[model samples]
Target: MKNILQVVHFPQGAVEDIRFIKSTNMPYAATGDLFISCNTSDIDANNGGYLIARLDKNFLNGIPTSLSWFNVVWAKGYAKAVHPWDVTNQGEVYYVSGESHGYDWSAMYCLNSQGKRRPVSNWRTHWLKNGTEWKGTPASANPFGQIDSVNYSGIVFKITGRCELRSWNMADFSSVQSDGNGGTRKGKWPADFLFNSPCDPQNPSANSPGYTGYSPEACCPVWGLAVLQLIEGIIMYTWE
Candidate 1:
């Protein structure tokens, strides 16, 4: 039989080459049950771009398959590019870009069996900030830009059906100023008391030493998941 295959093009560009492919030996035991991640770039632009494709065995035989593409646009006067990471059987993929706009960060997403993309909450909106000086050796100076200087602050938003979009402020954080009206900041604070710090033990002057500014509680949902798991474990152990 003649080989018949389908091809699709992304608005940004087309898939250039297949970089790597791996099959799982444990979770699922099937030949075509494989994960493929590749690179796609703008042919005309010639800077750097990336896309990902997860193919089953049938796809290798020329069947049409859905692919996910991510493109990075460089800011004015900035030369940069984005790169894609390897794919995992758990339907998760990650991408990083830095050459664009003189800064860079990584994004993680979960792919459904149908190839639909879903954002991973914990890894979402995570900027590649410089590791704390106490953590380890000082990281090499980021060529694109510093994470804090490039606005690493993020906001967590809930979407329908437990989905969410975590977005980070892409503007330069170094220059961000508090809204003159402190009472209206978007945190768990009363409108009447915006200038004071609830967590401040010393009650330092506004913007003064010992005055840790308004810090909203971490919106991490992992704690809730852990509690639920603990309860389940206790019940199971008690039955034993």
Candidate 2:
């Protein structure tokens, strides 16, 4: 014989509610239940962070028979808690975080069904620095060699762990050049040709000539708004 289960929906907040169903071959009654997770936001006033909720099976009309709650810390960037494929059998849960320690650093933690948490590993650091580029995005050029007028280079990072792993290069389309104007008009650009045109203080013929938009001494901030955007996208994709 076959069994059917029905699910009901209710409006709450940002997160949605979940329901479960089960069937058996023996002369036994199936059960229905719900699980929920709730918590405070870490990124915004109304969103993002960890949550804890409960699961009740074969709930009475007004009373719950079985209840259990679990906590999860939703991390920023490409980091989140994950369960093993056979989660029903695996009594442990794991969580991971993105490269927040450094250019390519990540962390992991484990929790048993009993809710005892422990560090799986220390913060794992991976240097994605390759010459002047970071994750394939042209960073600072070699001070010894004249920065390429038309070409650039950077480094990328590939991170992996038990719960999650990802490969991230510098923001796509980011470039570094000797002269911002595509290296046009010789000598009009930087004498060292080591900085992006917009950042080349020595560039005399700039896209906006006479305007000093370049900062030769300023090193690009490793963590910028662009980096945050990339990290957000990664986190969403990984968790979703």
Q: What would the TM-scores of all predictions be?
A: 0.32, 0.30
Give residue 100's error in model 1 in angstroms: 8.3
TM-score (C-alpha) between model 1 and the true structure: 0.32
Candidate 1, 222: how far from true, in Å?
A: 26
Q: What is the lDDT of residue 49 in candidate 1?
A: 45
lDDT tens digits, residues 1-240, model 2? 376455433345644333222211122433333334333345633335444334444344444443455555444443323211111123333334332323443333344455444322222221222322211112122333332321322111221211111112122113234455565322232221222222221222212221234322232111111121112112211211
The positional error of residue 53 in candidate 1, measured at the CA in angstroms, is 0.9
Candidate 1: residue 127 lDDT (0-100): 30
lDDT of each: 0.31, 0.30
- Using lDDT as the measure, the top candidate is 1
Looking at candidate 1, what is the lDDT of residue 86? 33
